[model samples]
Target: MMQKKAVDSVMEKIIAQDLEHKELESNFWTMSNHKWALLAWASAELDQSAALVHLDWHWDGINDFREPESRGELSALASLDELREMIADRDRPVDYASFIAPAILFGLIDEVHFYCLQDDTTPGLSSDLLDETRAKEYRHHNIDDLLRTTAKLSKPILFDLDIDLFNRATPFYLDGPEYHERIRSFLGKCSDLIQRAAVVTIAKSPSNYWIKNEGHYDWDEELAGELFNEIVPIVR
Candidate 1:
């Protein structure tokens, strides 16, 4: 149900010319060959959505965004061409949180997972990226990797982070033990509705937050302000 809103507009513009599908679809948004930059935009949008859903995040702003998404609503909202266009353009300025991603998924990853994914023999592995970048991408690229571990996330949490008992907002940055306590505290006391709502919000957010952003409802800003609020009235 992802309408052609973000990518559709740009797609109309680009498709007018005799552009070939495969030409722009050379996985241009990989770790290298970042020619279009739409990958960044797509990543930003996915990151923003992921951060907001799983880790209680929101966007600061974005810079020059070009192109549109080929389709709509992906696992990471990636692989589309127009989205790659919007991100790569120099005119746009997008910024995001740096620290929170690690907290969301530090423990879940390890050397074995890295090596396994790196193995070219593995089926469905993307052979595009160099073994070096794929091995230690966390060192350079800022991809959140929250959903990177698995398609269905056999082990979603890095350390069983939860959002239930968190009846109140907490700091984005935490030291060590305090982080685990907060997540445990929140999930412990959260109601079923709260838990289900939270998951739905997290899943649909990267792709559907714009439904609220588009002025479809009056409380987009209000609801956005208190992400962990767990109050159904505002968003409903």
Candidate 2:
């Protein structure tokens, strides 16, 4: 496992909004950050029409890393040392890790469709799943539902805007220098995504959608957000 400065790790998860979403959720300090073999999810074969996006973010110590607030009660800020102490307690290891990790499930996303954003259907794959599940297996999903599903997780779709920051700090929340590295890896994984595309499973009932990948990683999520804010879609 690649070790990082505890401060950077905390900042990474904070920027990515990768922390626990609920007060009664699991613990996170002893959690293990996942690695994706440094693969790229997008490839040169990507359709031209695909919108180029940019993402950037910084720490607020408030709002729980949620979207920017114009005016309201701000959340409390967490110091690097304090976050570390809470996470280091051995008794809370499992709870801590699960608290801020990518919740794993065997559930299915039915009626999921796909829509090639480009003019031509690029025969490529996606690594979103791979980043979460190390296996290279892919299942065919509903292209139409995947594309046309305007609603994201029972919430209204957000469009006509740039830069989306979720509740958790994702890899996208890292800084410029590190963000470049992430893009390189994501770009390199495009080939794998293309291959996995054919095998991805898509269910049609109830139209299930699994969002959020593994997180609370050691990488600085704030920097990542600043770097790749454009690539991630806003799930409002």
Per-structure clash totals for the candidates: 20, 71
| Cα lDDT computed for each candidate against the true fold | 0.26, 0.24
Worst 10 residues of 1 by lDDT: 110-119
lDDT of 1 by residue, 11-90 (tens): 65444321211122221111111122223223332222221222222221111122233112212333446434433433
Q: After superposition, how far is residue 64 of candidate 2 from its true place, in Å?
A: 24
What is the alpha-carbon lDDT for the whole of candidate 1?
Answer: 0.26
Q: Cα lDDT for residue 116, model 2?
A: 17
Off by over 4 Å in 1: 1-79, 93-178, 187-236
RMSD of 1: 17.4
Off by over 4 Å in 2: 1-182, 198-221, 228-236
lDDT string for model 2 (38-153, tens) is 00101112222121111112111011212344111112213434333333333422121121111111111111122212222322223443244332221223223333333232
